[model samples]
Target chain A: MSSKSNDKDLGVRKIIYDKDGKPCRSCNTLQDFQFATGKISAKDIQHIKNGTEIAAASPQETILNSKAYRRVDPPGVEELGRSSWNLLHSITAKYPKSPSDEQKLEMKQFLTIFSHVYPCNWCASDFEKFIKVKAPKLNSREEFGRWMCEAHNEVNAKLKKEQFNCDFWEKRWKDGWED
Target chain B: MSSKSNDKDLGVRKIIYDKDGKPCRSCNTLQDFQFATGKISAKDIQHIKNGTEIAAASPQETILNSKAYRRVDPPGVEELGRSSWNLLHSITAKYPKSPSDEQKLEMKQFLTIFSHVYPCNWCASDFEKFIKVKAPKLNSREEFGRWMCEAHNEVNAKLKKEQFNCDFWEKRWKDGWED
Candidate 1:
């Protein structure tokens, strides 16, 4: 077996077959995805609904309730922030462009990393309480971003004079810091 | 708000906690795992390392590669096959069993599922492929279970003929049968 590489370079490859392996629902074309050389990843028949074609009657194809999901590789520690950022941006999309998608994404990214070290349920009420009291309910992405920045300050204020762990901070702050 | 029902009847609640807010790893005291309903799910405070004491470590106390690992939930209608089964089982300790003890706990219950699903690779190939080809070794749980039962013929043989969705099977079987 080859030695595992770090997050920066996870070598991956694809498997090809004569007949299209998976067909897309819309055009009945093949679904495009990658596979690791020796590893197998999950595949989805593109655009299929609940074992049926998506009719206007079915608003959403299917909502997978399980918290578990699979991808090509085990998620990299560095990738967590980015994944969380995408999640936040998606959730913020529900509310009118209030919290700019970019800022909301940042807050979710930061919290994902924070939860790693802090060991708190991201959705736990106590944590939610901390946010609700310390930060107003974020109406927009900018407001959410401001809240997170403030939370960072609060943490540093307690460590007063002692700088926050730069390495830890850097890992979470994937995109360049605004301030 | 509805009071906590006896989930024990449902085979859902396995772990128990005493606190009303959240499980505090530091004190090993009972805490509410959920805030809205003040209900806690059954959980074991797994020392990222199974045998180590959480407190001995200075900065890293909780699960290593600390992240929220939501428990694997039951599969849905669409997730009934080999790929989804392997993906679902991979997350929980009940499915895969690791080859070595030194590997991460996540590796523990996964060996079985891994062996089975490794060859299938997103359902591209099933266990029957390995059996017929007499190549590509299979030994893990996934191999034994998924490949042997569902992928092979064990599952099909065991199922009552009535359980077979003849219409579905007829539609998918050899090209001539479908036409």
Candidate 2:
């Protein structure tokens, strides 16, 4: 195909490759994964054009958001992104104050495996990079929570969202204001 | 506390205790966490009374649904439940068929840690029980996916929701119908 046709075919999508160098739908939510692969609905296209909110339309009640990272019928990028953060953050929020060495080691292993098995290859690598910059602080809940907050804030900044004050990490994650 | 007052305070919520036996907000969304602890808005109370759809009130973008697990501010049981399944199911959906022994072991280890660090102690224990009943089958993607689907379906059944057709697991998770 001509370069122009290829560009036309791709539209605004940036193809992310999988282990086999094929377009990885799990990796690319918008470009290569969602629209390029014909996963997005016409309504989604309208939302993208108008910058409107995209609705997550999974009827399986998860499959609860089970396929969030895979297909539009199931979830797609936004749902996966939304849900993964929830699971990851909550896991850290509940980390023990003084985790045992084995616990710490397991946490490390979990993150490593998590980064590998995460459906979105590109996202998995990003998480790996995020962990590398400042390794998981497993000494105490406070230390680990702080590390996790900073890492999340970095992600927030990248997404152009407001950064949460890390000081309230406990209140935000573990305790509500009433506590 | 008077038994009558205690019951009144408990409201329609079922308090699920943590490891310490204290009311685990992580486990009980309605009883101990969201409303009993005063996390729910007055509007939420009205909705509860009216049986309307409950809104997940987190403007944090994520903390993409992170605190969906631990707190109502970020997310709550509903958010957490929805997201966890998404993350778990997608991971399984993407599992490498004929995975190396190392991958299977890692997946198993991942589940063990996942259950351990899971914020909701009740849910975590329940997940452990689920595993005990039908251990994870890791030989192939289909086997693993089928096992995961059955597990999720069991959860759905418990929640009084419809069971997913296991045959459609791949279609629902990895590929949309158009493909």
Candidate 3:
């Protein structure tokens, strides 16, 4: 089954192969993967070939260097991650204030399937694990919103990013912050 | 239930109320609603208050005028839409070349719930209608990718945007365009 020629041609797998020939989608944060994918620039590929440790550069630095990147190609994994989170959080914000039993069950089912089909293989696996340990809290809008925020913080922690304060999640994601 | 103060304070609903007092999320495209929610700028509000026909401006014009927009707020619906499509298309690209029956079932279930909970209420309703008429084809990667492209085109057609050709789906999404 793994012998499909198109699988090798997919580019993402070839770009991040591990020593054992396994595709290592989780080897670096999503931002670094974007650089490796050539979504940013050929300069990054050149850096990788020269062993210049391009992955060490911050995501902001990479973006600053690639002003033309947005026009040239579709979004890489970082863009995907950010966008998916925005959608998830926005949906949670709009969740019914007092959800019915059916609503709760539907939400739980949705999160479970979302983790399964998420494009980043490693990220999906991690989310699967996270949900298994702490299933979605879908009884009410606030509960679901906080749960989503915590799930995001889990990913942020894994990526060595600062943890977002869950207390302010509604302000951050739904209501605009008060001055 | 209708008396809930927070419901009106949600801003999204209040900004786009129709004659029947329903929050008409579909009254205008998501991009226009973003201006109403202050995701773009106060300048847009000023234009609206002055009866400058701001809604008549194109999306590109709105985006070009919002350089400071990102610094102050969460993503508006348009940004969320773009990001969501990126993730969805990428996931379809990576769907198994020959999916197992279980995998196909899981993908279909995901799409159904995704349509229900997607944050853009109008978009979600439209998708629900689309999927009811033409269910997701999940038997193989090619089928799934083509189905998604067609689904997206349906949305593009509604928004009066140009339809993307599905012939180059893999190149436009999964693989980078050949130089």
Candidate 4:
């Protein structure tokens, strides 16, 4: 574990695969991510007798080892994706029915910056292409929200996740289903 | 559980506690969120024999029962928070070392819209206050990243979680911590 050079320490790298063929931390599951970043080697991991060997091991090693998520590690791809979608859907849910020029511009800029700076390079590239074709329907909240739903469905289709019913977009994203 | 009215079906309600003293689904853990959303009543939850009782229960009953998250429901507050932070930190991690006037403006707009339309109303309100006190320091990626670190630290302090060392924000957020 050679320390990063001073010049490289503060610089941020894109969330992509490493040259060694390991997936980036943010792009894999927590356990895979731990392996990806060399936190635990494939050999050592297979042999990890218990949590005592884990670096800076959490007190509740049993729980941490058993859980799919650990608080100490950064989120992986699925987690990040879900979060981004939640933020995006929630935003569009409240988008004004009639937005001002500034609001529209800001919204456009937000999406632009969002997809551009999205950490996962591969996901960002796909998102960039997706936005290019779909073109944000920014005229009104309804249009924008509908567009977002369709966009989400497209991703869901590609991922083999069930297509969410677009009709319930607003209800699920903004309004909780009435019981 | 009478279904919502026709007029209310498509409406997106703010994420908040319900009149029945249940926290909104997005504000609690999966089990608590489930309880809150009436998917499982408190009594039933306490007495549930198996996954059969879960609405459209997943096949992995034991796994679903013990896990902190479920795919079927919207993200809870903590999940939402972690995801939002991933998006925000990653964005700033790549923000240009020195931004253009337009870039600066867009960044500011992004934060504004982000806070304004954040899904968790209570969290949003606190975020708004945090930003107000911190005021986004968006001159460059370095400044902005530092600002974000401080902002996150403030939240961590409030939540009683340990404060992340800002010095390594880039290493963690963008570049994988050097292994």
Candidate 5:
């Protein structure tokens, strides 16, 4: 095999193809992979077919080589999940102990809008379903905290991760554990 | 100094007190420091006061001792910022080039609610002011992307970080660089 073909073994391109041999762009992790190598640039495609190894660098490696690479790269689903959870739990921790009616309404509205706009399409859809089934409890801080903890546990279950101890919700997020 | 008092020198407790000597829970990094040593449990408080260094251990250390410590801890502000940026940019990258009117409305509503409910109180309030002055442009993907980049640059300027090149927004977020 040519060095260009050998580059596929490096686990860079996992291009899934349909029966007609067309690349399924959605199946690719790096969205622009097709555009980077597709018909727009026949010369580049020819370079690849000519067995040139230079055309085989992974999208990530190509990005890393860019001068602006140090600025910041877009976060994947996992990173988004972690950051979102941190923001959510912190908000719960700071929630008022005896919230007013208006405060409760605002909190509920916030959650509704959050579900609608959450960047991850699949995750957001799942969360919308979850919240619709079991609406958020915004009565008091303790109730809200526990409700949020259980919601998180639901996500953990879906992700096949271990469920957190809900009893220690405050201890973990708000108050530190008593050693 | 006794071991209990010595715990103070360990920099374990970074408590902030108000004018009345009451611990300002909001000002403290780790909550429950006062509660762990306060009068609610004289036995626990006395245990701390009686030169028992073990009783004075912070929750962070206690968590670090746990097996799940490596799994995840609450993200700090910087980590949260990085992850949030990632999610926002990725969403922008995936946004429809010629979005429907309904899509534009949803995006605007999402931003409004997001600004209000952003976990960081100060950051959220600041963002609220920002959106009010410079409303989100949802006419096209390019307009939205450039607007988002400029908003991020505003934040970067405030944080004294280098501004990103908006011209390369698509290249950095949607497409891999041309090597």
Candidate 6:
């Protein structure tokens, strides 16, 4: 009798693998194991702590915009942490209520940095090189620092001239952002 | 005066209506639309086409498995037509290559449709209750048909097993699915 024909009799949704098939990738016990997502065959279930269970006991304050340098090309950053904040910053920065060409260029530059923070165009300097290239004419670093400081002011000046609702812009600027 | 010193002299890249001097979405335009691989303004470019253009004098045969489609949510069938032909059937079907569950599902269903000349699921059916479900299932109709046929065969005959190579499978089983 085929194992497929006896699916109801086996008391499972479906047998993940054929009987007497490949050995387990995880635990040495090749007989019993649950399949995980990503379609990888495994012989053991790795214990991952789900936050819901811990939430009731500890009520810990969640960290916002936390960085995990350990993770490279990590999945679910938007669902798990600061990706939502970053996305909002980008949308607002790029598509401000109203924008001018200069402002757009600034937004575009920042977006480039945000998307890909690679090594410098000249040698191997990091994001610092990006900041310098974006605002090149400055003789001193102090002026660049001032520009970063009043970056919001420049955005606001463009927005005011475009004639968008001031109250809305002020509220968003003051209240911060949610997903 | 320099364009920076006097905004009116800035030409196309000049700021038009700037309020808070923030990133303006409306007024910004791509500065290097003339160059390849540079920023192209969203507003300027139009009429993108994907597919080979043959001369009227002599029509050339299309390369096997060359199709193009846009990417979107619940992705359109037209979008996967090229991928279905090229990558799915041409490559994987020949070798019995193991693909992800999603890819497997796509190929299996595509095979059924590629062989069938009729698009509708049912040729003969009771009509009284068909008023509510006017259209036959679009996504999984072919899968359902094959499953039904296989189930019927299993119930009637004790066994039907066949082993064949990729060339035989492509030539005999798949209709109009060849170079």
After superposition on all C-alphas, the RMSD of every candidate to the true structure, in Å, is 21.3, 5.9, 9.8, 9.7, 10.4, 26.6
Ten contiguous residues minimizing lDDT sum, candidate 5 chain B: B24-33
Q: What DockQ, between 0 and 1, does each candidate earn?
A: 0.02, 0.41, 0.27, 0.27, 0.22, 0.01
Tens-digit lDDT track of model 3 for B71-124? 234455567678778878988977888899989898888889888888767678
- Top candidate on DockQ is 2
lDDT of 4 by residue, A83-140 (tens): 7888788678667788888778878777876776676667777888998998898889
Q: List the residue pairs that clash in candidate 3.
A: none
Q: What do the candidate models score in CA lDDT, each in turn?
A: 0.29, 0.70, 0.67, 0.65, 0.62, 0.27
For model 1 the TM-score comes to: 0.20
Model 4, B5-108: lDDT tens digits are 33122232232574345465545455555544555554455355343454442222222232322233455677778778888887776678878988888778
How far off is residue A55 in model 6, in Å? 12
Best by TM-score: 2
Model 5 preserves the real interface contacts to a fraction of 0.27
Which of the numbered candidates is closest to the native, going by highest lDDT? 2
Model 1, which residues run further than 4 Å from truth?
A1-30, A33-179, B1-84, B88-179
Q: What lDDT tens digits, residue by residue, belong to model 1 across residues B103-124?
A: 2232322333233322112232
Lowest lDDT block of 10, candidate 5 chain A: A1-10
Residue A118 error, candidate 4, Å = 1.3
Indicate the worst ten consecutive residues by lDDT in candidate 2 chain A. A1-10
Clashes of each: 21, 8, 0, 2, 0, 22
The segments of candidate 4 whose C-alpha lies over 4 angstroms from its true place after superposition are A1-71, A96-105, A138-142, A157-162, A175-179, B1-71, B97-102, B160-162, B175-179
lDDT of 2 by residue, B1-179 (tens): 11224444335455455565455655665423555455565567667677897766433343433443233454567678888988888888789988999999999988888878787777787888898788999999999988888988888888778777787787777665452
Candidate 6 Cα outliers beyond 4 Å, as residue runs: A1-82, A93-95, A118-179, B1-179
Q: Model 1: number of clashes?
A: 21
Ranking by TM-score: 2, 3, 5, 4, 1, 6
> CAPRI verdict on model 1?
incorrect
- Candidates 4 and 6 compared: the better one by lDDT is 4
lDDT of 6 by residue, A1-179 (tens): 12345334323223333122632111111112222121212212221112222112112232223231111111111111122222222234223344455544544444333223111111113334444555522222233323333443343354352322323332222221211
